[model samples]
Target: MLITLGRRYLRPYAPAIGVLLVLQLLQTLASLYLPSLNADIIDDGVVVGDIGFIWRTGGWMLAVSLGQVACAIGAVVLGARAATSFGRDLRHDLFDAVQTFSAREVGQFGAPSLITRTTNDVQQIQMVLLMGFTIMVMAPIMAVGGVIMALRQDVELSALLLVVVPVLAVVMGLLLWRMLPYFRAMQGRIDAINGVLREQITGLRVVRAFVREQREIERFGEANTALFETSLGAGKLMALAFPAVMLVMNASSVAVLWFGAQQIDRGAMQVGSLTAFLSYLMQILMAVMMSTMMVMMVPRAAVAANRVVAVLDTQSSVVEPTTPVPLASVNDGDGPRGVLRFDDVEFRYPGADEPVLAGVAFEAVPGTVTAVIGSTGAGKTTLLGLVPRLFDATGGTVSVDGVDVRSFAQADLASLMGLVPQKAFLFSGTIASNLRYGRPDATDDELWAALEIAQARDFVEELADGLEAPVTQGGTTFSGGQRQRLAIARAVVRRPRIYLFDDSFSALDYATDARLRAALAPRTADATVLVVAQRVATIRDADQILVLEHGRIVGRGTHAELLASNATYQEIVTSQMSLEEAA
Candidate 1:
C-alpha cells in the first residue's frame, strides 16, 4: 500500500527524486573513499615519515569531506521538497474525493476517521518518504561499497560480515513483524480519541446542562488511555530493536579485533590495514542499522497509506453525469424557470429495510409557495434533501425546470437553489463573509436588503461592527434564533431561482416568524419557495400545503382545504392549536 501511494503521487516529482538519489550516491561515495584515504595516510605518510605525502593526502581528504557535506545537504533539501509536495497532493485528492461524497458515503466513514486519514495518516506516509529519500537510498550503496572496500583492506577479515549481517537482519525483521499490528491498532485508537474529543467539545453545552462533566471526562480519559496503550506497545518493540542491533554491532567489532590481531602479528597484515578494515566493518554495520530503521517505519506507514488510499479509492454514491445537460438548455419552454417536480420519488438509506419516502410526488411552480408539514420523523427533511441531490431518490426522478437533477451539472443545480438547512451552520468568519458565501459579489446595500427581508437587519445594525462582526464556527457565537435569521439572510442574498427552507424558522418566536414570512413574500414573489416545517401556523397561509405521514403524502391542499377534508392535517393542527386558533 505504501509503495502504491508513493508511486501515484510521487510520480510528478520524478526529477526532484532523481536529483536526490544522485546527491545521496555522491555523498556515500565520498564517505567510503575517506576511510581508504585514512589507511593510506597511516600506512605510507606516517610510518614512512613522508610529510609531503601527509600534506597532499590531508588536502584530498579535506576536499572529499567538503564535497560529502555539500551532497548530503543537497539531498536533504530535495527530499524535503519532494516529500512535502507528495503530502500536499495526497491531501488535496482526499479532500476533493470527500466533497463528491453523498451523505451515505460520509456516514460510512465517520468524520473522525476521515479527519485522521487526511491529516495524521498522510503525515505518516510523508515522514517515511522523507526518511527514504535521505537515509534509505544511501544504506545499500554504503553497505555494498563498504563490503568491497573491506575486502581490499583484508579478505579474511571480511568473512565476519556473513554471520553478523544475517543475525541483525533476522532480529530486526522479527521485531518489525511484531510491531505491525500495534501500529494498525494505534491508528484506530487515534480515531476513537478524536471522535470522543469532537463529540464532547461540540456538545459541551448539553453536557453542562445535564451536569455530566465528570462522566464525560472519564470517557475521554478511557479513549486517551487506549491510544496510549497501543502506542506504548509499539514503542516497546521499537525500543528492543536498537539494543539488539548494537549487541550484534559490538560483537562484530570484538570479532574483527580478535581475528585482525592474529593476522597482524603473523605478518599477514599491516597495523594500518587492520584499523581500516575495522572502520569499513563499522560502516557496513552502520549502513545495516540505517536500513533497519527505515524498515521499522514501513509497517506503520503502510497501514496509514492503506487508510488514505481507501478514501481515495471509494467512489461517491452520488455520481456526476459524464455529459451533463446545460441549465439553459434544459428550460425548454417549461411551466416556469424555477419549477421543481418530484415524480413518484422514493428513497431508502443504505442497509435499511423500509424506505424513508415512498410514492412521493409534488411540484412547486415559480411565483408560488409550497409548504410541507408533518409530525416528527415524517421524512420532511429527507424529502427536502432529495431536491438538492444530497441523496438521490432510489426510485423515480427529481427535476428542476424540465431537466432531471442527475442530468444537470452539480454547479448548475446548486446555483439555481438557495438551501437553508435545518441546522443553521456558519463558517468561522466575519458577518459579511458568511453572508456573502452564496453571492461573493453582493454589495453591502444588497446584504442589508436581504437581512431586512429575513428580519435580521435590526440586530445586525445594532451590533458594534454591524456586518463586520465576528462569527465563530457553526455560528455558536450567536443565539439559535440569530443563527437561523443569518442563514436565511445568506440564502436570500443569493437571489436564486428556487429557495429551500428546511425548518429554518424553528428557532424564531411566533411574531418574528410571521413578520419574516410577510416580508419574504413580496421579495420572493417571482421565485419558487419550498418550506418544510413542523409548526402548522408557519405554513398555514401557503398557496399549497402537503401533509406527510409514514413517508407518504396523506393530504395535499391549502390550509382551509386540508382542514375541511383531511383528518391527519386536522389532527396535527389541533395538537398545536385550539379550534378557534385553527380557524
Candidate 2:
C-alpha cells in the first residue's frame, strides 16, 4: 500500500527525486572516502614521520569532508521538499475521495479513522520517505564499499565483520518482530483518541448541559493511557536496538585492535592497514544501524498505508449507470418542469435488517407544495436524502425532471435542487459569504429578497454591518432558530428547480413560520417544494401530505381528505389538537 500510494502521489516529482538520489550518492561516496583518508593520514604519514604526506592527505581529507557536507545538505533539502509535497498531495486525494463518498460510505469508514489516516498515518509514511531518501539510499553503498576497502587493506582483520554483522542483524530483527503489533495498536488507539476528541468538541453543549465533563474526561484518559502504553513499549524496543548495535560495533573494534597489535609486533601487518580495517568495520556497523532504523519505521508506516488503501478501495454503493436511459419527462412523460417521482422505492441502510423506506411511491408536480410529516425515526430525513442521491434506493427509482437521478451527473443533479438540512451548518465566515454559498454571484438585492422569504431579513438588517455579520463555525454565534433561518435563506437564494426543506421551519415561532410559508408560496410557484415537517399545522395547507410511521407511509392526501379517511391522521391530529379546535 505504501509503495502504491507513493507511486500515485510522488511520481510527479521525478526531477526532485532524481536530484536527491544523485546528491545522496555523492554524499555517501565522500563519507566513505573520508574515513579511508583518515586511516592513510594516521598510517602512511604520521607513522612514517613524512610531513609532506601528512599535509597532502590532510588537504584531501578536508576537501572530501566539505564535499560530503554540501551533498548531504542538498540531498536533505530536496528530499524533504519532495516528501512533504507527496504527503500534501496524498492528503488532498484522500479528502477528495472522502467528499465524493455518499453518507452510507462515510459512516462505514467513520470520520475519526479517516481523519487519523489522512493526518497522522500520512505523516508516518512521509517520515519514512524522508529518512529513506536521505539515509537508506546510501547505507547499503557505504556497507558494501567499506567491506571491500577493508578487505583490500587486510584480509585477516576483515573476518570480524562476518561475526559482528550477523549478530547485530539477528538481535535487531528480534526486537523489530516484537514491536510491530504494538505499533499497529498505537495507530488504532490514536483513532480512538481522535474520535473521542471530535465527539466532545462537536457535542460540547450537550456534554455541558448534562454536566458529563468528568465522565468524558475519564473516557478520553483511558484512550490516551492505552496509546501511551503502546508507544512506550515500541519506544523501549527501539531503544534497545541502538545500544545492541553499538555493543557489537565496540566489541568488534576491541577484537580487531587486540589481534592487529600482535600482528604488528610480529611485523605481519602495517599500521596503515590496521587503521583502515577499524574504519571499514565501523562503516559496516553504521550502515546496519541505519537500515535497522528504517526497519523501525516500516511497521507504523505499513499500518497507515493499509488504512489509506482501505478508503481508496471502498466503492460507493451509489454508482452511475454504464448505459443510461435519459428521460426528459419526470414521470408519465411530464417534461422537465421540476416534477419529481419516486416509483416503488425501497431503501435499507447498510447492515440494516429491514428497509428504512419500504416500497413507498409518490409524485410531486411542479408549482406545488408536498409535505412529508412523521414522528422521529419515521424515515423522513432518509426519504429526503434519496431525492438528492445522498443515498440511492435499494430497489426502484427516483426521477427528477423526467430523468432518473442516477442518470444525471452529480454536479448537474446538485444544481437542480436546493437542500436545507435539519441541523443548519454555517462555516466560519461573514453572513454575506454564507448567504452567497448557494449563489456565489447573487447580488445584494437577490440575497435580501431570499432572506425576506425565509424571515431572516429583519435580524440580518439590524446587525451593524447587515449581511457582513461574522458567523462562527457551525453558526455557533447564532441561536438555533437563527441558524435555521439563515440556512433556509441560503437555499432560497439558489432558486433551484426543486427545494427540499428537511424540517427547516421547526425553529420558527407559529407567527414566523406562518409568514415564511406564506411568503415562500408565491416564490416557489415555479419549483417543486418538499417539506419534511414534524408539526401538522406546518403542512395543513400543503397540496398533498404523506404521513409516515415506522418507515411506511400510512396516509397520503390533503388535510381534509386524510382526516375524513385515515385513522392514523385522525389520531395524530387528535393528539396534537382537538378536532373541534382544529376545525
Candidate 3:
C-alpha cells in the first residue's frame, strides 16, 4: 500500500528525485575520497619530511573538501524540495477523493479517521521521504565505498567489518520487528484521541448543558493515557536499537586498533595506513546507524500509508453518470422555473436493518408551497435530503423537471436547488461573503433583496459594519434565530428553482416566524417551496400538508379537512395550539 500510493503521487516529481539521488551519490564519493587523501598527506609528506609533497597533497585535499561541502549542501536543498512537493501532491489527491465521497462512505470512515488519514498519515509518509532522500540514498554508497577504501588501507583489519556489520543488522532488525505491531496500535490510539477531541469540541455546548464536563475530561484522559503507554513501548525499542549499534561499532574499532598495532610493530604496516583504516571503519558503522534510523521509521509509515490507501480504495455509493441526463434549457416547459418531484422513493441507511424512509411520494409544483409536518423522527429531514441527492434513495427516483436527479450532474443539480439545513451553519467571514456563497456573482442589491425577504436585513443594517460585519466560525457570534435568518438569506440569494427548509424556522419567535414566512411568500411565488415545520400554525395555510408517522404518510389534507377526520392531526393541534386556533 505504501509503495503504491508513493508511486502514484510521486510520479510527477521523477526529475526532482533523480537530482536528489545524484547529489547524494556525489557527496558520498567525495566524503569517502577525503579520508584516503588524509592518509597520503601523513605517509609520503610528513613521514619523509618533504615540504613540496605536503604542499601538493594539501592542495588536492583542499579541493576534495570543497567538493564535499558543495555536494552536501546541494543534496539537502534538492531533497527538501522533492519531499515537500510529494507531500503537497498527496494531500491534494486525498482531499479530492474525500470530496467525491457520499454521506454513506463518510459515515463508514468516521470524520476522525478521515482527518487522521489526511493529516497525520500524510505526515508520516512525508517524514519518511525526508529520511529516504537524505540518508537512505547515501547509506549504501558510503558503506560499499568505505569497505573498498578500508581494504586498500589494509585487508587484514577489513575482516573486523564482517563481524561488526552483521551483528548490528541483527539487533536493529529485531527492534524493527517488535515495533511493527506497536506502531499499528499507536495509530489506532491516535484515531481514538482525535475522535474524542473532535466530539468534545463540536458538542461543547451540549456537554455544558448536560453538565458532563468532568465525565468527558475523564474519558479524554483514558484515551490519552492509552496512547502514552503504546508510545512508551515503541520508544523503548528505539532506545535499545541505537545503543546496540554503537556498542558493536566501538568494539570493532577497538579490535581493529589492537590487531593493527601488532602488524605495525612487526614492520608490516605504516601508522598512516592504521589511521586511514579506522576512518573507513567509522564511516561504514555510521552508515549502518543512518540506515537503522530509517528502518525504525518504516513500520510507522507503513501503518499510516495503509490507512490512506483504505480511504482512496473505498468507492462512494453515489457516483456520477458517464453520460449525464441533459439539463433543461433556460426556458422551463414547467415554464422556466424550478419544479421538484419525488416518485415513490424509499431509502435505508447503509448497514441498517430496515429503511428510514419507506415508499414515500410527493410533488411540489412551481409557484406552490408544499408543507411536510410530523413529530420528531418521522423522516421529515430524510425526505428533504433526497431532493438534493445528499443520500440517494434505495428504491424509486427523485427528479426535477421530468428528469431523475441522478441523471443530472452534481453541479447542475446544485445550481437549481437551494437548501437551508435543519442546523444552520455560517462560515467565518463577513456577512457579504456568506451571502455570496449562494450566488458568487450576486450584486450588492441582490444580497440586500434576499436579506429583506429572509427577515434579516434590519439586524444586519443596525451593525456598525452592515454587510461587512464579521461572522465568527459557525456564526457563534449570532443567536440561534439570527443564524437561521442568515442561512435563509444565503439560500434566497441563489434564486433557485426549488427551496427546501428542513424545520429552518423553529428558532424564531411566533411573530418573527409569521412575518418571515409572509415576506418570503411573494419572492418564492415563482419557485417551488417545500417547508418541514414542527408547528401546525407554520404550515396551516400551505397548498398541501403531508403528516407522516413511522416513515409513512398517515394524513394528507388542508387544515380544515384534517381537523374533520384525521385523529392524529387533531391530537397534535390540540397539544400545541389553543382550541380557538385549532378551530
Candidate 4:
C-alpha cells in the first residue's frame, strides 16, 4: 500500500526523486572508495616511508570526504521536500474526496477516523518517504560496493562475510516479522484513542452535568492503555533487533582479527589488507542497519497508506448529473423563482428495517411559508435534507423552480438556497466573518441588517467590537439562543431565494422568536420559506402546515383547519397550549 500511494502521489516530484538518487549514488561511491585509499596509504606510504604518496592520497581522501558530505546534505534536503509535498497532495485529495461524500458516506467513515487518516496516517507515510530517501536509497549501493572492495583487499578474508552477513539478516528479519502485527494494531489503537478523546472533549459539559467524569476518564484510560501495549510490543522487538545486530557485528570483528592474525603470521595477508577488510565489513553491517531502520518504519506506514487509499477509493452515493441543467437556466420566465416541490419523496438509511421518510410530498411557492410540525423522531430533518442533496431521496424527486434539485450542480443548487441547520455552529472568528461565511463578499452593512432581522443586532452591538466581536469554536462562548440567532443571521445574509430553517428558532424565547419571524416576513416576502419545528406556536402562522407522524404527513392545512380537523395536530397543539389559546 505504501508503494501504491507513493507512485500515485509522488509522480509530480519525479525530478526531485531523480536528483536525490544521483546524490545518494555519488555519496555511497565516495564512502566505499575511502577505505581503499586508507589501505593504499598504509601499504605504500607508511611501509616505504614515502611522504609524497601519503600527502597526495590524504588530499584525495579529504576531497572525497567533502564531496560525500555535500551530496549527503543535498539528498536529505530533496528527500524532505519531496516527502512533505507528497503528504500535502495526499491530504488535499483526501479532503476533496470527503467534500464530495454525502452524509451517508461520512457516517460510514466516522469523522474521527477520517481526521486520523488525513493527519496521523499521512504523517506516517511522509516520515517513511523521508527516511527512504536518506537511508534506503544508499543501503543497497553501500552493501554491494563494500563486498567488492572487501574482495579487492583479500578474497580469503572476505569469506567470513558469508556466515556473518546471513546471521545478521536472519536475526533482523525475524524481529521485524514479529513487529508487523503490532505495528498494524498500533495504528488502529491510535484511531480508537482519537475517537474516545474527541467524544470526551465535545461532550465535556454533558459529562459534568451527569457527573460521569470518572467513567469518561476510565474510558479514555482504556483506549490509552491499548495504544501503550501495542507500542510497547513493537518497541520490545525493535530493542531486540539492534542488540542482535551489534552482537553479530562485534563477534564478526573479533573473528576477522583472530583469523587475519594467523594469515599475517603465515605471510598470506598484510596488516594494511586486514585493516581495509575490517573497514569494508563494518560498512556492510552499517548499510544493513540503515536498511533495517527504513524497513522498521514500513509496516506502520503501509497500514496508514491502506486507510488513506480506502477513503480516496470510496465514491459518494450522491453524484452530480452528467448533463446538468444550470440552476438559473431552469427558472427563465417560468413563473416565480424559489418554487420547492416534493413528489412522493422517501428516504431509508442503509441496512434499516424501515424508511425514515416515506410517501412524503409538499410544495411551497414564492411569497409563501411552508411549515412542517412533527413529534420527535418524525423524520422532519431527513425530509429537509433531501432538498439540498445532503441525502438524496430513495424513491422520488425534490424540485426547485420547476427543475429537479439533483439535475442542478450542487454548488449552483446551494447558491439558490440558504440552510440554517438544527445545531447552530460557528467557526472561531469575528461576528462579521461568521455571518459572511455563506457570502464572503457581504459588506458590514449587510451583516448588520441580517443580524437585525434575526433579533441578534442588540447583543452584537453591545459587544466591544460590534460586528467584529470574536466567536469561539462551536460558538460555545455564546448562549444557545445567541448562537442560533447568529446562524440565522448568516443564512439571512446570503439572500438566497429558498430558505430552509430546520428548527432554527427553537433556542429563542417566544417573544424573540415572534419578533424575528415578523421581521423576516417582509425581507422574505418574494422568496420561499420552509420551517421544520417541534413547537406548534412557531409554525401556527404558516400559509401551509404539514403535521408528520411516523415518516408520513398525517395532516396538512392551515393551523386552525388542522386543529379542528386532525386529531394528531390537536394532540400536539393541546400538549403545548390551552385549547382556547390554540384556537
Instruction: Give the alpha carbon lDDT tens digit for every residue of 104-175 in model 4.
Output: 999999989999999999999999999998888899999999999999888998899999998888888888
Could you give candidate 1's per-residue lDDT for residues 1-583 as a string of tens digits?
A: 8989888998989998998999999999999999889989989999999999999999999999999999999999999999999999999999999999988889999999999999999999999999999889999999999999999999888889888889988888898889888987888999999999999999999999999999999999999999999999999988898889889888999999999999989989987888888888888988888898898888889889989889999988787999999877766564568899999999998789999999999889989999999889999999999988988999999988868999988998899989999999999999999999989999999999999999999999999999999989998989999999999999999999999999999999999999999999998899999999989889999999999998999999999999999999999999999867898
Question: Residue 294 of candidate 1: its Cα lDDT?
Answer: 91
Model 3 residue runs over 4 Å out of place are 328-336, 578-580
Q: Using alpha carbons, what is the TM-score of model 2?
A: 0.95
- RMSD for each of the candidates: 1.4, 2.2, 1.8, 1.2
| lDDT of candidate 3 at residue 426, scale 0 to 100 | 99
lDDT of each: 0.92, 0.88, 0.88, 0.93
lDDT of 1: 0.92
Q: What range of 10 consecutive residues in model 4 has the weakest lDDT sum?
A: 326-335
Per residue, candidate 3 scores C-alpha lDDT tens digits across 475-534 of: 988989999999999999998889999999999998999999999999888999999989
Which ten contiguous residues of candidate 1 have the minimum total lDDT? 327-336
- Candidate 1 segments exceeding 4 Å error: 332-335
Model 3 quality (TM-score): 0.96
Work out the TM-score per prediction: 0.98, 0.95, 0.96, 0.98
Model 2 Cα lDDT, one tens digit per residue, 1-583 = 9888888888899988998899989988887787778887888789889999999999988988998899889999999999999899889988988888999989988899999989999999999999999778999998898888888888877787889899988888899899989988988999999999999999999999999999999999999999999999999988888788888888889999998998889998888778778888888888988898898898799899999989888887777677654433334344547889999989997678989989789999888899998778999999999988988989988988657889887776888889999899998999989988978999999999999998999999999989999999999988899999999899988888899999998888999999999999888998999999988889999999999998888999999998889888888889889987656
Evaluate model 3: give its lDDT. 0.88
Error of 1 at 213 (Å): 0.8
In model 2, the runs with Cα more than 4 Å from the true position are 321-336
Candidate 1: the clashing residue pairs are: none
